[model samples]
Target: MRILIVEDNALLAQGLSAMLEALGNEVLGVAGDAESFVTAVLADRPDVAVVDVRLPPSFTDEGVRAALHARELLPGLPVLVLSQYVEDTYARELIADGTGVGYLLKDRVARVDDFLDALHRVAAGGTALDPEVVRQLLATRSDPLTRLSRLSRLTEREREVLALMAQGYGNVEIADRLVVTERAVHKHVGNIFLKLDLPPEDSGDRRVLAVLTHLGAPRRTARDGRDGRG
Candidate 1:
């Protein structure tokens, strides 16, 4: 995958670039601030962008703004955002963009193999999120789907599969981890989607859609320059 990095910290950016290159992905360039990030997007247009949540000048959320703008210019462009902090609002907004997205903590990069796996998944038009982000979304009680009557429709095993799906595990991975047949996992996934009244997509990589179901609302957009406040 060809990746463009948007981060202000020089050491971290260099380390990430080196790590990604070592993992066999090409690092197209690094942008320290939002302006350069947008410039790189318009000019170079790498296959994926790995961005920091906070960036130069104001350092509030310039990186995400730049990423959103890049997506505006190039809709559905892949982005994997890394943050030192877990901002639920940021996660929700990014996921609202639909697919080919990831939001992970900076600490996750230390787990090099897993981080590379997630980056590749995002670049290949899939979805990934930090485990904590999944937890936060799952814990949102406002979701009408979480009501006992609706949730009671799922068997315990199916619920387990739903949780794993929210964690960005593909059916094959879920099957391997649960020691079940891939066919069984697929059946459970279909059942879960059906019980939740979600329309089935043939690809089944709709991790963002699954998360939105947990949130019990349609995808939301943040206002100009403001990720919805926590």
Candidate 2:
């Protein structure tokens, strides 16, 4: 894939460009500031772009601003924003785009293979977020998370199953990921719908929304590996 690198830190940007290049992809242009970031993306229209969470000038959310702008400028262009921290609002804003997007901590980049895998997946139209980031999101006092907590209480396995579902895994995909049977995945998903009190018409796309909303701010109902339920 031809990709752009939008990051303010010079050394980090150079390092990321080198690594991405080693993976057999072109790094079209590396921009160290917000204006240049936007310009490079609009000019090149690469397959995917890796952006920092913060950029020049403010360095607070310039990358976030660039990502939002790319949504309008490039439309379907896939983007992966790496950050040093999981700012709740930043995650919320990125997730709003719904697909072909990834928000992960900079630390995850150290896991080179997984990081590249995430890039490839996102470029191929997938959602990618760190597990701990998801965990942190679900732990907040958001309305959706609260409801998911109530929904989570209804079953033993459903809560465990919900995360994989939100991560864009299908029955077979989730089965392999969780080391479970396909039939078991189906049964757990069915129970999830019933327990969550989904609408009668909730199937397919609607089901995806339910899981997304639930996981968007999912509340954890377990302590460690133990379920909260008796």
Candidate 3:
């Protein structure tokens, strides 16, 4: 796969570039700032782009903004953003559109295999959100009562399954984590969609939408009293 790196830290950028190349993937180029990152992206059109959440000058959310702009220029372009901290706002913005995107903590890169897996997942138009990011998003609520009311429809187990799904874990991985059968995880996922009133669609899209629904500040509604299986 051909990849592009957008990190302001020269050492980190070189390290990432070397890692990608060592894995037999082509490294198009490394851009240290937002402008250069967008330029490289529009010009090379690489298979995937690995970006840092912060960039030159402000070192704030320049990378996030640049990434959004690049996607605007090249719709559906796969992008995997690496961040040092859990910036819930930026993470939500990246996954707002769903597929072909990922937001992982910079620490995960030390886990070479897992990091590569996330990169490939994003490259294949799949989501790869960090579990820490999901946890932070779930916990960052202004109104505890409203948040509880909105999620009151879901059973404890179903909520657990949904959180794992938001973290980009598949049924098998979720099952492994929860020490349950894969079928049980699938059933929980289905129930989550049903209780959330998400329409029937591709399972991947439903997974993302379910996460968005959980993260978004929607009004509380009446709850269905049905018990979830598994």
Q: Give one clash count per candidate, in the order shown.
A: 0, 0, 0
When 1 and 3 are scored with lDDT, the better candidate is 3
What are the runs in model 2 whose C-alpha is more than 4 Å off? 154-156, 198-210, 214-230
lDDT of 1 by residue, 155-220 (tens): 999877877786578888989989999999989888877887766653555644654555542463
By lDDT, is 2 or 3 better? Answer: 3
Q: TM-score, each model? A: 0.85, 0.82, 0.87
Candidate 2 residue-wise lDDT at 207: 53
lDDT of 3 at 18: 90
Per-residue lDDT tens digits of candidate 2, residues 1-230? 99999887888889888998897899998988878878888889889889998887888998987886876677767889999998877776666654677888999999997799779878987777776666676666367656666665656567667666555556787788879898998888887777666543324323544555554533223442223111
Question: Predicted candidate 3: what Cα RMSD to the true structure?
Answer: 6.8
- Order of all candidates by TM-score, from best down to worst? 3, 1, 2
lDDT of predicted model 1: 0.78
Relative to the unseen true structure, what is the C-alpha lDDT of residue 221 in candidate 1, on a scale of 0 to 100? 47
